[model samples]
Target chain A: MLKVENINMSYGDLQVLWDVSFEVNEGEIVVLVGANGAGKSSILKTISGLQKVSSGKIKFDNDDLTIIDPAEIIKKGVVHVPEARRLFNEMTVEENLIMGSLHGEAKEKRNETIKKCYDLFPRLKERQKQAAGTLSGGEQQMVAVARGLMSLPKLLMLDEPSLGLAPVLVQDIFDIIKGIRQQGITVLLVEQNVQTTLKFCDRAYVLENGKITLEGTGKDLLNNEHVREAYLGI
Target chain B: MDLFLQSLVSGLLIGGLYAIIGIGMTLIMGVLKIINLAHGQILMVAMYITWVLWHTWGLDPYLSIFITIPLVFVFAEGLSKYLLHPLIEKDSILPENQVLMTVGIGMVLVELARSIFTSDYRSIQTSYTDKSLYIGNISLSLPLVIAFIIAIILTVGLFYLLAKTDLGRSIRATAQDKFSATLMGISAAKITILTYGLGSALDAAAGSLLLPVYYLYPDVGPLFTVKAFVITILGGLGSTVGAIAGGLVLGIAETFGATYISSGYRDATGLVIFLIVLVFFPGGLKRFTKV
Candidate 1:
């Protein structure tokens, strides 16, 4: 479980996130839907300890992650898959996954986890020896997600996993996300594609201009007049 | 033809040592993405440590490697932790503050060596220094041959570290994307410190290997600094494989230039090749290996 309480974040003089709060129970897939520059990514960054929070607490299963280092945050079983699927481009697909298991218990179970990842993405298994940068967008996204899984995370945060993928590939990626939750791993996803994300996620939150504007069950938000008008473009 | 063969052989032997030096610089550049301008000075410092050990304790230059490496590793680690890492967080007018800091560090190292050891040229006298092994009419300097073998072994060891080890994975990950590496539980700060130390240790090995044939003085650092930069650029900014090729190419080019042209043009030869590589193969040997 993860709880983000009234976190305020800024970039130098520019305030990007204002009193944004959200929560995700164990094994739940929570989606944060917002327009471009609506601070969706910023919220994830703040939670992952990549961006410094001006005020607020990010607690995961009673452990304070707000002031901890990103590496330490990860060791606590919180893995963040950043936007654009920032895989180690020059490294082999296998090496990129190996990087995921660089510390703690993940290092011990690296080979096993890698096997599991390969099984999950059989296409990745075929291209294991190839450089990640040489892969197609869909394959690269698969490598990114596989890499995140390699860390044996309790909570996995993904930022726009379907950002640049084709429509068909986006569906495959979403299916993978659903599969991941079925594996009993909690997921916090930020997406610009609202309709699909709301349909799949158990709970959803609407972030508008650095603040949480709406939060409810996925079905409730999906059918809300404001949500349909603003996000679903009904 | 004999002259060509001799020059080529000699160049390759020397290139092995140069490769060791270049690899150190490349590793540093790869992780920190900053040119360690003081690289040569660090080598110089290592050479001085080797010299002192050899002169005072009768330790063989090769034997002193074990001592010099760990010492330089600690020194460089401290330098990175206390000096360089702090500057990374500070806002600067120029983006190249780190590179400029290395220049300043180089100057300080040179001055420190000069103050302590003075400007006198020094060289180690080992029995194998002048001995050579013959293969037909061509001969290989015994010390150089040994140095070359050691260099190759060290390089192979470095490759293993980068490819097979967890630390290596974290380092490569950090080089690719620092933020992402952190998310994977790699402490970028720790990796940077360790990388600086590792790079410095390699430089120490190079300095030790070169001590038998190369003369040492406070100003020796600049020449090497220039050579290491040339190799790093020629090999590709952060590619260890590229650095090795760059080192050999520069080595061969310099030797051939010295033999066919003039000894004075030996250094210029490397510079010329560096320019050619810059203009033609901007990615260095890394463009070839794609690693």
Candidate 2:
């Protein structure tokens, strides 16, 4: 489980996140839906220790994550697949995965975990020797997710995994997310594909202008009046 | 034809030593994204250490390498950790404050060596220092041939470490994307320290290898610093394979210039090739290898 309470973040004088608060229960796929510049990515970056927060606390399983080093946060089983996939462009697909398990227990079980990742994305296995940058958008997304899995995360945070993928590829990525949930890892996803993400998530929150505007069960939020009007356009 | 053959063979031999020096600069540049201006100064310090062991303890230059390399590694790691890494966090007006800081460090190191050694030209005199091997009309300098073999062994070892180790993967990952590497649980700070240290150790090898033939003076550091940078640019910045090629190209060019053109223009040869590479193959040899 993860808890982010009343967190405020800023870049120099420009504040981005204001009093943002959220939680994810164990094994739940929690989705944070927002428009561009709604601070969804900022929230994830803060939790992952990539960005400093002005106020409030981020706790994963009752341990304070805000003050720790980013690498230490990853050791606490919080693996973040950041925006744009951020794969090591020159590295082979397999080397990128190997990097995911660079420290601690994950390193000891790296071979087994890599085998599991290849099973989840067989296409990656076929292209393991190829440079990650050379892969298609869909395959690169798979590599990103599989790389996150290599860390054996307790809470996996993904930012815009389906951002630039085709509609058919987007569906496949969501299916993989569902498969990941079935494997019992809690996922906190920030996505722009609101309708599909809402349909897939267990609980969802709509973030606007750096604050949560609405929270409900996935089906309820999908059918909500303002959600349907502004996001779904129905 | 004989002169050309002789120069070519001699150039290749000396190029092996230059490759070691270039590899050190390339590794540091790759991981830290800064030109360590103090690089040749660090090599200067290592040479002094080698000289001290030789002068006082009567140890061979080759025998002193095992001691000097690790000593320089620790020294460089401390410099990176306590000096360079701290500058990264401090807010500064100049984006190249780290690079500027290396220039200051180099000055301090050169001054320190000067105060102790007094800028006198010193060379190690071993039993094989002036020995040579002959094949028909061409001859190979014994010290250079030995240094070349050692350089090849060290280079192969370095490539193995980079390609086949956990620490190496973390280092490459950090070089590629510092943020993603940290997210994967790699301590970027630690990797930077290790990389600086490793780079310094390679410089140690180069310093020791060159001592038997090259003269050592406090002012020698700037000359080598320029040579290392030229090789880095000529090979393409941060590419190990490119550094090797750059080293050979520079070595051959300098030898041929001395033999065929004019001895006074030997040092200018590397500069001329560096300019050509800058204009034509801006990415260095990495563009060709695509590595």
Candidate 3:
């Protein structure tokens, strides 16, 4: 239920996203696979209102996402779990989760929502009192995801949730994403782990040099020769 | 030994007030990541407000905190939201433009106070102004003891707010990661303004408390601004707990210096300790406490 139309984004004079457009229907796990500097992160950033597009529009379930504040975008039920997990390192894990649901309905259901998050990642419940920075990378990722869920969003956009995790932990994170989808929450994931992400994602887009070069079902792209050679390295 | 005990007691008492001021600066510094050159100026204005309340209505300096806090909070909020926040949005060549703007704000505040108050040193006399409480060899100023008790209450209250309240969590979160805070629907701009207002409110409380025990003028803010930053650095940048310790350390050092060494070297004593702390404990007391 999200549409990004012909968005051109830049940093100063250097343009990073040129006429990039994509869509994710409700309840789907959409993945954007690209190499470093391919503008995958930039697209997510623009959608979340962290960076504004110079041209074109972003419409989310009929709301004009382009013209609103970033905080307002979250209120519209679109939450972004940014790259690097970005947990408030100094704050306790529970405190970090509390930060995620600071407005409206999410805030009202804060205690209940936190209980749900802890149930999703019981390990976080165990380390609830510990500072977020002290957690393992896997645990920190869980906090980041759990924190995102705390927002009670219709759509959760995650950027590189498995970036620094161990191989085993990476699979676990992928499984968590699937579990999230099963809970009726839509996910838009940006990842460099093409083979793994492609296997699980409902649909996938191939971004190269600020452009969406290809889009298809996950299985379609996995079997495509260009995708195998360029991304999966198969 | 009696003299030493006396200075130590008095130093600890005064340090409580200093901690309040430092805590305010630390909150602003932690969230906005600016030096806040106008911090002491805000306190100065609060003192003047307190002075006016006393001079006009004969309100006790202690009772004036309620009025001064909300007044300074709104004024400081406007300063941060209108003056500093906009500068951050602009594409300035120097990233320090926001900081420079605070310096300008401080100048304006000082000038405004000068125009109105005319640089005159003003002090208030209450029933307890000259009274002291004697504990055998040590005598404590009554006003200072009351300020100290109030300072303790306020510090505890602030700690509770930061540790338990949602607004405090948003503040700490924004201080830690502004982008992430926004993604979580915590408006960093509003948080910044709130933090500035909260910080100034604490400063106002300190100013009101200090009125019965100290003299104030338009130029009084610069000295306290230096002290606030020194306390901020001493306590460790952005650590509320550290600010308290930093303020106490400074208060004790200055008092001891005045007692043992030449009284003229009291301010210099705090500077010496500040430099030493910068060199040895660059992380401030946070390095030790990890708070």
Candidate 4:
């Protein structure tokens, strides 16, 4: 489980995230939906230890995350699949996956993990020898996902995986996220595609202007007028 | 015919040394995007280090590689961490600004070498000097041959390291995208320092090898540095293998230019090729690897 309490993030004098709080139970998919600049990505970044929170605490299990280094935070089973699919463009799809598995697990398990990733995204296996930069948008997204899986994180935090992806591919990506949860990895997803996200997530939060506007069960949020009007376009 | 052939052989032999040094220049530039103007000065410093190791400790210049390369690597790392690293870290240091920094560093190094070592030409003569083996009508000097062999080995070895190993992969990644490398848990600060150190160490190796072949002087690096610049730009900025080929081409051009044209301005011929490449082919020659 993960806990974020009263986290405040800022850039110079501009506050990005103000007193934001959220949580994820073990093996559950919790999504944060927001428009651009709503601080959905910022939340993921703060939890991943990339951004310095001005105040408050981020907890993984029972341990305080502020003191841990980003690399060590990842090793402690919190892997972040960054937005824009920042793959090692010059490297093969396989090599990029290997790099993700750099810090955690044994060599043998790493291989097994690669095979599992390949099973999940067979396109990556087919293009194992190809450079990641050349992959199609959907395939590149798969590599990015499969790469994050290499670390075998207890909680996988994905930042805008569906960005720039087509609507059909967006469904496929969300289905993959469902499969990842089935594999027993808890996910904290940030998404702009609100309708699909609510359908897939068990619980959800709508972030508005760096503040949590509402929180409820997936079904409740789907039927809520503000959520329906603002996000779902009902 | 003998004159042409003689220059050709000697050209190939010395070309190896240029390739070795050029690879270092290219490597550092590729990662840091800093044109190391003082690159030649580092070679001069290495030459001085080799000379000191030879005179004080009574070690052969060739045998002193173990001490020279590592020391240079450490020195280069420390130098970047303290001096150049700060400027590079600021993110304002572009390729053009880096050229200035390198030149500034080179001036300091050259002046330092000038003050301590003096400008007097120094050479370490061994029993093998002038000892050349003759096969058919061709004559091969031992030291020149050794320089070629060492250059080839180091160039090939570095290319392999950069292209094959995980650390090398990390370096390449840092070279292309610093932020993305960090996302993968690779440290840019650490990589830059190591890359600077590795590049400086290569300069040390070349300086030590060339110490006997050429006289060691504070200002000696400028000539070779110019040659290195031409070689790197002509071959390709980021390609190690390109540097090697560029070195060989420059070497052959200089030798043949000296033979067919004029020996005094052999460097001019190399410069001319540089200008042509600049005018027509801006990318130089990229040794692109298939992933």
Candidate 5:
């Protein structure tokens, strides 16, 4: 489980996150739904140690994440698949996956994990030798997710995994997220595709202007008047 | 015909050594995204180390490689760790502080060498320094031939490390995308330090290889630093394969220019080629080869 307690984040003089707070229970897919610039990505970044918080704490299974080095954070089973699928563009597809499992147990089981990743994304195996930049948008997203899996993460944080993906590929990505949950890996997802994400997530939180404004079970949020009007557009 | 063949042979041979020098700068540039202005100065320090070993210990310049590489690696590692690495965190107004820091490092190194060595041109005398092997009307300098072989071996060894090894992969990964690499648990700071050290180690190798035939002075670092810079640009910013080609092209071009256009214009010839590449190829040989 992960707990984010009243974290305030800022870049230089401009405050982006104002005492934001949220949590994710074990073995559940938690979705953070918000408009553009609502600080969804900022929350994920602060949790991953890529960005520092001005106040409050981020705890993953009771480990103080604020002081941990960004590189060391991943070793504690918090693998963040960042927004836009920032794969090593010049490296081969397989090389990108190899980069994922570079520390500790993941490194030791590298070969097996790579095999598992290839099985999960057979298209990637076929294009294993090709440069990652040359892959299609959908395939690149798959590579990013598969790369996250290669780290053998107990809790995976996905930041807009479906951004820029086509509608058909978007469905495939959502299916993969469901499958990931079935494997008992907890997921923290930030999404712009609110309707589809709301239907599947165990719980959903509405992030508005850097603060958590609403939280409820998936069904409760689906019928909420404010959620339907702003996000679902019904 | 004979003169052309002779110069061509010598150029290619020396180019092998130049490739090692270029590769070092290229690696540092690729990973750190900063032009290491101190590259040649570090090489100069290594040459001085090699010279000291030869003068005081009677060790062959080639044999001193075992000593010079580790010494230079640690030295450069410390230089970057203590001086350059800290600049990354400083909220300086000028973003070019890291590159400027290298310039300061170079100046200090040159001054240090001058105070101790007194600017006297130093060359090591070995049995093979002046000897050459003949084939019909063309001859090869024995020292150069040996250095060329060593250069080739080092090049091949480096290729293996970059292509097949885990450290090499991490280095290349860091070079391609520092943020993503860190997200994968790679300490980009550690990689930057290691890369600076490794790059200088290669420079040390080139310096040792040059010592038997080349003269060394306190300010000799700038000349090769410029050469490394030209080659890195000529090879396209951070491409490894391009560095080798760039070195060879510059070497052959300089020799050909010396032979045909006049020896005084040899350095100018390389500059001319560099400008032409800048105007035409722009991306260096990597634009053509896609390496």
Candidate 6:
């Protein structure tokens, strides 16, 4: 559904993403894993049209994603649930979800969608009126995911969805990712949590210092000794 | 007793106009998080447009709103795109750079007005400027009363726009956090332009009211700038409702002070509130302390 080819990105003289490339097939969960400053998030940013690439082309659903604005990208049914669960702190969870439908209103089915989101995360429905800032870390992540889904996208790229969560909450988030895949939305996930990401994702890529160092099935990488040592820190 | 009732009624009438002007300050501050020191000068500029529409075309000042509002919106849009957007984009106006730049813009706009229109005060004295209606002991100038009503309508209309629309959601998103807003598919530049246009529209309405009650010059805007700055700080920078309340409070207090105290220091209410907000309610009537 999406393709990125040889994207080079830099901030002034410091290169952040060098000759990075990746792809997301329809309804597939592709995990991009790496250590800090490894350009995994940069790839997601490039795909979402938020970060400028020094050189490359990004094609999504047969459209040039690189040439468009972030709004346009989302309107094209490619929504990005950014890292840090950047829900508008002052807005209610409902409002945050409403913000997701910026391209146009899905008014006729809004109630149904809200119900679907509630079924996915009952905790969120209970606290719908609460300010997003006041939610627990896991609950806020749910709001972020729900908000991203509000766009009714064919693909959702999530950056570090399990970041800063407890072990139980992290497990719960992984389960939700599986549930999202069941709903038929393609996902490109970026994460530093190796074992969970490898277990959760089908096809995975390892990024190291702005380059793709490894690519294979989650099982292959799990059994690979070098991956275990450097990534799983075993 | 009658004089007091009269004063109170008159104070409320002008209070409404102050609310209109103060909302412009709040609207600009909300999305951009900067005081538009040039705001008052923009108001003066709009007032001149109203004057021209009245004097040149024989259109009533109130009747000219249909044109003036959109004109002001486009004018502010151009200014935001060409001037404010670039500075905001470059991240050039940090805490250290903001005051000098905003005040500098204020001065430039004022001088631009002066050079173009000269320092002479202008009055759009339509035939009805001084006509009044007396209901019981309260005598109200028809223009002043109409200005107040229109100002109220503009304020409520703007509040509705800010609170009830998709564009408003994007604006609120941008105002709260730029990065998050972008992540949510909002273009910060577009929101800023829309916000500036809305702010300028409020300023135009305020200027429309000023047409009948006040004489306008390049210098007229500075006094308004002072009042707007004070009102915005008192109300909390981003709260349109706060701006309305703060403006009315300042208006009534100043009106009473001018009558009972020294008229020389009448307008000191705004300055006094500015200092009070700085020293006391620094977070503004509520806590803008970001916590």
Q: Which stretches of candidate 1 lie over 4 Å from their true place?
A: none
Better of 2 and 3 by DockQ: 2
lDDT of 4 by residue, A1-234 (tens): 899999999976899999999889998999999899999988988887778899999999978787766656777788888899888887789888887776647234888999999999988899999989999999999998888888888999898899999989998999999999999999999999888899879999999999999999899999999998998787
lDDT of 6 by residue, A126-169 (tens): 99988999999999999999998888888988899999999999
Q: State the TM-score of the second chain for every model.
A: 0.98, 0.98, 0.98, 0.92, 0.98, 0.92
Superposed Cα deviation of residue A125, candidate 4 (Å): 1.8
TM-score of chain B of 6: 0.92
lDDT score of residue B262 within candidate 2? 95
* Model 1 complex DockQ against the native: 0.87
lDDT of candidate 2 over A1-234, digit per residue (tens):
899999999989999999999999999999999899999999999999999999999989979999998888888999999999999988999999998887789999999999999999999999999999999988998999999999999999999999899999999999999999999999999999999999989999999999899999999999999999989999
Order candidates by lDDT, high to low. Answer: 3, 5, 1, 2, 4, 6
**Clash pairs for candidate 3:** none
Q: What's the true lDDT of residue B195 in model 5?
A: 97
TM-score to native of every candidate shown: 0.98, 0.98, 0.98, 0.93, 0.98, 0.93
The C-alpha stretches of model 2 lying farther than 4 A from their native spots are none
Query: What C-alpha root-mean-square deviation, in Å, does candidate 5 show against the real structure?
Result: 1.1
Model 4 accuracy (lDDT, Cα): 0.85
lDDT of candidate 1 over B156-219, digit per residue (tens): 9999999988888888888888988888888899999999999989999999989998999999
Off by over 4 Å in 6: A104-111, B1-9, B91-105, B126-128, B131-141, B287-291
Candidate that beats the other on TM-score, 3 or 6, i.e. the better one: 3
Q: Report lDDT per candidate.
A: 0.92, 0.92, 0.93, 0.85, 0.92, 0.83
Error of 1 at B254 (Å): 1.5
Worst 10 residues of 3 chain A by lDDT: A64-73
Which residue pairs clash within candidate 5? none
